[model samples]
Target chain A: MHKKLFIPGPVDVKEDVLQKMATAMIGHRTKDASKLQRDISEKMMKLFYTENQVLLSTSSGSGLMEAAVRSCTNKRAAVFAVGAFGKRWYDMAIANNVPADLFEVEWGTPTLPEQVEEVLKTGKYDVVTVTHNETSTGIMNPVGEIGEVVKKYPEVIFCVDTVSSAAGAKIEVDKWGIDVCITSTQKALALPPGLAICTISQKAYEAAKKVENRGYYLDLVKLYDYIQKKDHQYPSTPSLSHMFALDYQLDKILAEGLDNRFKRHEEMANYVREWANKHFEVLPEEKYASNTLTNIKNTKDISVKELNERLAMRGYTISNGYGKLKDKTFRIAHMGETTLPEIKELLSNIEDILGL
Target chain B: MHKKLFIPGPVDVKEDVLQKMATAMIGHRTKDASKLQRDISEKMMKLFYTENQVLLSTSSGSGLMEAAVRSCTNKRAAVFAVGAFGKRWYDMAIANNVPADLFEVEWGTPTLPEQVEEVLKTGKYDVVTVTHNETSTGIMNPVGEIGEVVKKYPEVIFCVDTVSSAAGAKIEVDKWGIDVCITSTQKALALPPGLAICTISQKAYEAAKKVENRGYYLDLVKLYDYIQKKDHQYPSTPSLSHMFALDYQLDKILAEGLDNRFKRHEEMANYVREWANKHFEVLPEEKYASNTLTNIKNTKDISVKELNERLAMRGYTISNGYGKLKDKTFRIAHMGETTLPEIKELLSNIEDILGL
Candidate 1:
């Protein structure tokens, strides 16, 4: 039996969506491919609430995350980290020989707008990256507020990693002044893990054009140029299987209605948080807690590893705290196709197993 | 009706293999995921005839092509271009600011062994990249002979792009002293286009370690280290759908027996060549012709684009000449799971459509 994935991503995809992965292959250079891609981009724009040109890559969200930093950072980068995912942006900058500085808050704390303003005031940075939702600590940062602050710096490109957020929450890209927003299919999009999509503002493209040494494969400027020249087709042969599924799934998501989907996610998040409070303590404060997943402090000091193992036997699974927080915290994801009833069942099972 | 893919890549995958792509998702960090990847690497070793470590990337083969040039080329790179694919190697190196020089041959020509030796003798180049098969011109370069020449230079890392020929043809990585051999799943592997696999020898790893700025996402050294430390697991969340399908398809490939598979490809190539010679001029000399795809000169000066459109109407598709060779030549791919009778049928349809 497959354990229900209540972990961050690679969530329980719907059976109908999985069937779309088996769609017949198509020549990527043909008109059919361009139409498939164009339709996808149109839907993605509606979801992101932006007029930015959306780009698709045959990689995990990390691929585009790396692309954002390597392609957009010209002078220097200020990466604000709430946890592991934010730190990855900094790591990518350092790996690519891009000059950068890391401004990391505590694992469970959100990156405030004032802190971002202070960094931009330095006038040494050309790029600013923030984690819209940190999967590790379950802290959803105030990206709208941060975007307001970043708008004051016309030269700085604002990029956000919404890998685990996106469809579960409202991301007003244009209103937030987001230059680039990156997310993968597996998270709130509720598809498999092969493709990553991002919205690129014209400013980000112009900023990237000024920077040299944006390596091929992950070069954002080059990708933008190719899509413009090729009528919505990508430079490389993209995963048409993923595109087929995404196109279908996006319809399903839109049919659910964006406002209703966001509301459903919030309801699930509140239920999980309430349950966590009764049993243990929520890791992050109520205001900053992520709507996609809830991180619970392991105050009872249960063996999270063992708990997960037992949960697997019961056909339910959740994530232990990521990296340094392992054993100290546990996480329950309510994103993807997971619903409130499913969350209640998982909690009930956990209660039965733990005899709480 | 779905048109069968006859292009170089994104080939027609078997229905069973396509179904495997719809396999249920699994956490990339799990032991099961490690087993799946480990199984793939072992089988890939047999296919490539090497003991070198096999690394998988979620992006297309170009991703790793850029990785090889960026990570291993420290002093300088000598890129040999027979056609578009080879030129891409040089393009990637230049994009990443890796100091490199291109030694290009005319279209439909192979990179000769003596030419490679002459370039290596210059001693300024520490990395040499060759396209083993040029999909555009259907010229399978004399890479084994070129490898013999590159072996003399102990300091130069040899990289080969076998994207179109890796599984359809035999590649003796260790015997050829090729440090990095790259191929994608959509080609001879008969899988989807989302995954690319490569073999990296210890020498390549050591050379990459000395490089200070290997970008993150496509960083070969970082990937190698992570695989070693994590029991064949990748650092990023890999496309589990691809891995599941690859693991299943590699079994079918091994069951087919490598020698038998190569013989089938050669037999199909010979059959296609005979038809091409009788009807149209064969692009590239017979000695250098690729066994996977045969590029035929449009000797009669017929409209290749119109031919493809007509072919598409009959539930079939073929490629027009690529780039500069467009309309001058047309191509038919006989790789992947394509059979001899299917080739005969396709040719018969083209003959009937064109009044050959």
Candidate 2:
């Protein structure tokens, strides 16, 4: 059965976008490939609202997240965590042997700008990692305000993981002073799960050049240098299939207008949140709740696994909370190409299954 | 025009194989995904002729190559270079700040067993990297022979790159004592470029455990642990679209019978070599020529650029050498699903274009 995905990522890719993945293979080093990559990069810059260089990788978003932390952090790093995804950044720093300290709030709470300001005042860190929209806890950090706070520290590199929120939310990268903003194709991008995309400021690239033992595969300095030298070509053979589809999808996205797309996502999120409020409580504070996915507390104490099984039978699926929050909460994603009508239909089906 | 690709990789993907890439996306954490991955792993082991654990990465083959060198080389690495890809291994080691020494053979020559035996005798290196098939030089190194030499030094971990010649050539991974054998999907796997596949021996896994600063994204130990604990699910989201296609393609390859597939590749290689010898000189020594692609010396002084342009007009494309050998030689790949009739047609078209 073709179950509709309301899960966090690898969300339902439209047929046209999926068809683009089947485009004929082209030589990665050829002029045709350069054009494809350049086109994607330019389109991504518009979407990200950044003048920084857009870089692409053939791995998941975590690949670029690791790249950002390992390559740009020459000194110590202060990692602010709100959920599982935020903790992953700290873990990446530790694994790479980059000096880092993790400042984590309660899972459902947001990372406040004051906390960021307090950490930067210490002068012990040269880099700060933040998750703009954490998928696990359904909390969207106040990155705009946090970015304002980070701007005061000229020496620090600010890196944000907008994996789930990128295209769904308005992220003014340059205005926010985000040095490196990373996202993958699977989430709000509404594409398959192969490619990861990011934009890096000149400051981050310069810092990356000074970092030692940054590794080769995900080295930002090398990646930036290679693309610049080879006219947007990667050092290694990339997934051209993903690139072709991304190019096509990006066109569709731009045609829809960024503001309009963001508005659509906001509307869908609002609808889902309203529906959740009527039956269960939203996991995060209403003000900081994510616009891409919603984590709802299991107020009725329904068996998530059984509910999912029933949903699956109905040709629909939603995530049963993540990590420690499993069974205690459930998540319904509203990002990507999800429509208002689709959200209503899914919610209606859920209500029928649960008798809510 | 839909040109038939004869390049070393990103080679012609059959329509059936390409169609598989468009399969609907599924949650990476779902049971369906686990089943897909487990099936791929089992099939890959059969194709690799190994009982070792198979691992998959969403990046190109270089990602896993970087992983092996960075994760397992706790002491020093002795990188044996037969061609461009070999030098890349050394480059990766240096970039990661791993201690490594490069042993280079002439471009067109193979890495002899004597050289590996000599290096292992030094006892200065704990890990050794070898390219089983040098794509740039069209030389298939004596890996089976080199493996015998490596067997004498049980303390040294052996990593082999079979990127361009795994499914198209006969490689008995277990018999060759290969600790880490890596290959990407694009080449002989008859799939689009994206996923990289490798098998790790128990010895290599143990060595990786003791290594520090392995990084987070491509950390082999973490990847291994995750797959073991989660039933083949990766720590990071994978390119599930590729997995769907890989599962389908593996069935086709296995159904064709491994021995028959090997024979087909051998025949195609022999036929191309004979044609090259009749009109142009083959680049690599006849004894060590690859069974996947043939590098032909431009002894007739024909303009490869013009020849490719003409070929392109006729709905065909072939590689115009690589790096320093550009224009001096050209390559024609016969890997994956390329058949006898297609080879004959491509050669006949080339002959007509060159007036040979």
Model 2 Cα lDDT, one tens digit per residue, B10-119: 98788888998999989999899999999999999999999999999999999999999999999999999989999999999998889999999988999999998888
Give the runs in model 2 whose Cα sits over 4 Å from its true position: none
* Per-prediction DockQ: 0.86, 0.87
Show the colliding residue pairs in model 2: none
Q: What's the C-alpha lDDT at position A290 in model 2? A: 95
TM of chain B vs. native, candidate 2:
0.99
Task: List A-chain TM-scores for all predictions.
Answer: 0.99, 0.99
Please give, for residues B1-356, the per-residue lDDT of candidate 1 as tens digits: 89988888899988998998888888888899999999999999999999999999999999989999999998999999999999999999999889999999999988999999998998999999999989989999888899999999999999999999988999999999999999999998988899989999999999999998998999999899989999998888899998989998989999999999999999999999999999998989999999999999999999998999899899899999999999999999999999999999999999999898
